[model samples]
Target chain A: MEIKILGTGCPNCKTLENRVRRVVTQNNIDARIIKVEDIMDIMSYNIMATPGLVVNEKVMTKGRVPSEREIHELLTL
Target chain B: MFLNPTKNREKAGIRKYSALWTGILVAIILIVVFVRFDLFERLENGVNWFVFGLLNLPADSHLASALEFFLYDSIKILFLVFVIVFLMGIVNSYFPVDRVKNYLSRNKLYGFEYLMASLFGTVTPFCSCSSVPLFIGFVSGGIPLGVTFSFLITSPLVNEVAIGLFVGLFGLKTTLIYVISGVLLGTVSGIILQTLKLEKYLSPWVKDILSKAQHEQEVFQLEKQSFKERLPVIWQEAAKIIKGILPYVLIGIAIGGLMHGYIPQGFFEKYIGKDNPFAVPIAVILAVPMYSNASGILPVIQVLVSKGIPLGTAIAFMMGVVGLSFPEAMLLKKIMSWKLIAIFFGTVSLCIIISGYLFNFIL
Candidate 1:
């Protein structure tokens, strides 16, 4: 599994990224998590809001941080 | 959206899309509703009694107080929004984006830098929408993410109306506290962002924009103009902004007016007042989707204050309404992804709640 966190480095964006990392670690998910900070790449996904989460190739959430349980569900699915 | 020349000419010739038509439509609707509901008749009767003070009224009655009860409250709010939106237009028109970018783009993101950026943002009269564009400009100019965050946090939290109202209603000490808290929130949030090293999460497009950026040095080089010339430009910009925001201002005023004249005092007190420990958080949550500027909502605040709502909670609600409205979040969705928008809302809402609690304790 692959998870990506996206934003332009605003505080909220950073917080979301950190939360994603924590959730990934705590759940012991066998996934490669990556952070994508570039604006163009994020825009290419047609997401206008930042601090987004992409699971695998699909965009999971935008402009928010999801709880560990939510991340776990996304990971499992 | 190809426009045929004949259709364009016919459309121009019709003159149907006029402000007068809009104004007339609004007036008709208001009049029809008031008449149908007997609201106007009641208002007339109420005014006469209130004005003459029917029961052994004092000879020297305060007309201003009476006027304030009915009209001034709404008028003041509309006026404040007008001034803010007008000033925002001026800042947008006159203040070159590159100037702000240059000032904030130092490579270092020290505490002092964060403080300065936050203070600068607080002083400048930029609305959230305008602030986003400037934030983008700053990021594009290679300003450190933490420093940029400082500016973004303080911009909406420490607006001019909020400061003035704090000073006027709550006195200097409370106003100072609000200002200090705003700065502290910005600084702490920025530091936290820096610590997380979240720059790596920014989308590649932003990186590309920043990497290719030769700073537009010429943009800020203003030629010295005579005061007369400058005045006209300022007036023109103010007029343009006023025209754009006038309808929204009026709508806010209308809602405020209704709340002032009709809403029962007990309602707000029962639900959202200081007696309820949960009021602060509940108000914050409710305020997230509602949109109103500081001025438009002042009348509601006035009623809430009179009805025993906690000052901190009321202000928090106001801040959430203005700063985190759903429209704002949605508008941002055009520029940011849904994930980013959610995070932004979460962070700002948390900050607003913290400030609310801080004010409640200190005040």
Candidate 2:
């Protein structure tokens, strides 16, 4: 599984990175998490807001950060 | 759309039209009542008193005065934000900036095109930090490098909130100078950069993004929509704008408000006054590090004006704050290399410092 965290290192982005990393570690899922920092690259995904999450090249969520349970559900699926 | 006269007089029936007129009348009456009663003033005082009660501080204390300014300015500035955001939604619904961009980008006349682009930038309302998205759109629309840079520079620097604050705080003459200088700076810098042929400095992937053949083009055919049909769309856009930007507005005003009441009077004059020849460059250099939304900087500017800073120096400082924001530069970094970003910063800073000293000398 490929998970991409998209942001430019704002506080919310940092919080999201922490949350997503924690979720990935606890779930023991075989997933590769990529942090996309470049504005052009983030724009290429067509997400409107920052702190976006992409799974397998498809946008899972954008703008808002989700909870731990939500991440787990997304990962397991 | 609010602009369709036909929907109001001809088709809506006498009863509906009468109701609309009645609504208008009532709104006018309420506004008159509020003004006559000085309700806004009363509300401001009420907030101040409430803050005093919460803190149990003396009415004449510095802390109390600071709290009052903070609360009052935050709420007042935010109210302006709401009204401007709503009106911009309605206006954009009719004018549709992207269409204007599409048509205007085709103009080969560099100087005139840059002027028009800068004017449009002033009209298009943004809360703050929205230059990158518009930059993407302009670049993708095939606008020239100079014209796009002019639009990008003018858009963020002379927004609705900034202009509104300028007019309210500094009066019409200063506002006029500001708008002209801002547009001039944008135009000159754009022409300079374009003449330099620095397109190679852009991140190469920008081409890939432009050529990707994927942009959503489903602008609702507003010309076809009945008046009733467009109302909800305007409302939705306004709501989206508020939801997206209110937090930034509130936080910005909050910080600015604190600075408003707390900062000592004559602070600028002591440091970067007209008497101090190095003030303009020093003020410009100081502004780059203190990043805040343009709105956040408004209250501070308010305090600056009240502090008797030289007009040119203060405006130079404001230009510095809005034009030289660190985050904004960083955001642009993804699309351009460090060198280009530095040039962009250096060009604008030099322009602002020059304007500062020029305004001081002239005005």
Candidate 3:
């Protein structure tokens, strides 16, 4: 599985990235997590707010950080 | 499909809270009525009495007066901000950002689009740091650059928190003027920028994004939730906002209190007072580099007004600080060319200055 976190390195984006990292390690999910910091690429995802979570090229959430449990569910699924 | 699990339990929770929520709703209404009927005057008097009569501090002392100012303003302004944020939070849950974005992209409102955009700017709660993504989203979504500009301009300048602080500090009349002027400033600036046909000034990065296929439109499932189900989330959001801004509010009030007690009457009047023909422009210019949120700046503005600065100049400074900050410029720099940023800032600054002069002349 592939997960891309889209943001311009805002604090919220960092928080989301950290949460995603923790959820992945704790759940032992087999997924590659990538952070997209470039504004151009982030906009391609069509999210108006930062800290978007894209799993398998599909946007799971945008503009807010999801809980760890939510992230685990998103990845495991 | 999403993280919203335990649907049955959530529904049950909503049912259980309905009665308690009703009581909360009634209490809120009663408090609004109480605040409306000049109850703040009584509160102010109580503070004054506590400071002067109970504390036995001489009214003439600056320390006593400053303490009184700080305590009264902190309590009154915090309460006012909480009420405004809570009410706006409920409104926000109903009008989510995705819905607004979809609506803006899907419809053509003739000339009224700019007005609609400006109004959305006021209601949307995103901070200045989020402006870049929003700007990119709107432009790439095929919304006009001008309409996007309207949203970007007013989003920071006018908001519920700012309104609450304005009402707390400057009263309803000035707050109304500030809000009307802020919205108009955004609308007018957007219209003017749109006519300039400055699309080429956009960075190559954005132009590249514009050429790509637009992403699939997704409807937000969260928006379909009933108000009762959304109530707990709204309360949590409102509380979070209050907690976030509490420190700024206190520090601002503290600074304002010092000025209120220690600054001699007519001190600021000697320079930026109404008699100074250039005060408005100076205030606006001085405020551009210094960035602070509305909560931090409004208390200082209240003190400045008390120090004999004209209301228009003070308000102009407040708008400049909130709207045309260096940090916002730095963020926008990632997406826009220097020339574009200059034009955007220059136009907004000019509008603010003109409004300042108008405000001083009228008020």
Best by lDDT: 3
Model 3 per-residue lDDT tens digits across residues B105-211 = 77768899899999888878866668898887777667888989998989888887888899788888988999999999999999999999888888887877667
Off by over 4 Å in 1: A1-77, B1-68, B74-96, B106-109, B123-132, B160-180, B210-220, B239-270, B292-295, B330-337
Residue B171, candidate 1: alpha-carbon lDDT: 47
Give one digit per residue, the lDDT tens place, for model 3 in A1-77: 99999988877789899999999888888889999998778877878887899999999988777778778888877
DockQ of each: 0.03, 0.13, 0.63
TM-score of chain A of 1: 0.88
lDDT of 1: 0.61
Stronger candidate by lDDT (2 vs 3): 3
CAPRI-style docking class of model 1 based on DockQ: incorrect
The digit string of per-residue lDDT tens for model 2 on B1-363 reads: 566897664554554445445435654675588679986688787886688876678987776777777677656555545555555555555555565566565555645887887777776654233456556666776676777788778876776557655654455688889989998888887877778776788788776555643433443232444435555665565566556556666665566556666777777677666778987898899887666555556555667767767888888888888766888877777678899889888888888899999999998
**Highest TM-score scorer:** 3
Clashes of 3: 0
Global fold similarity of model 1 (TM-score): 0.58
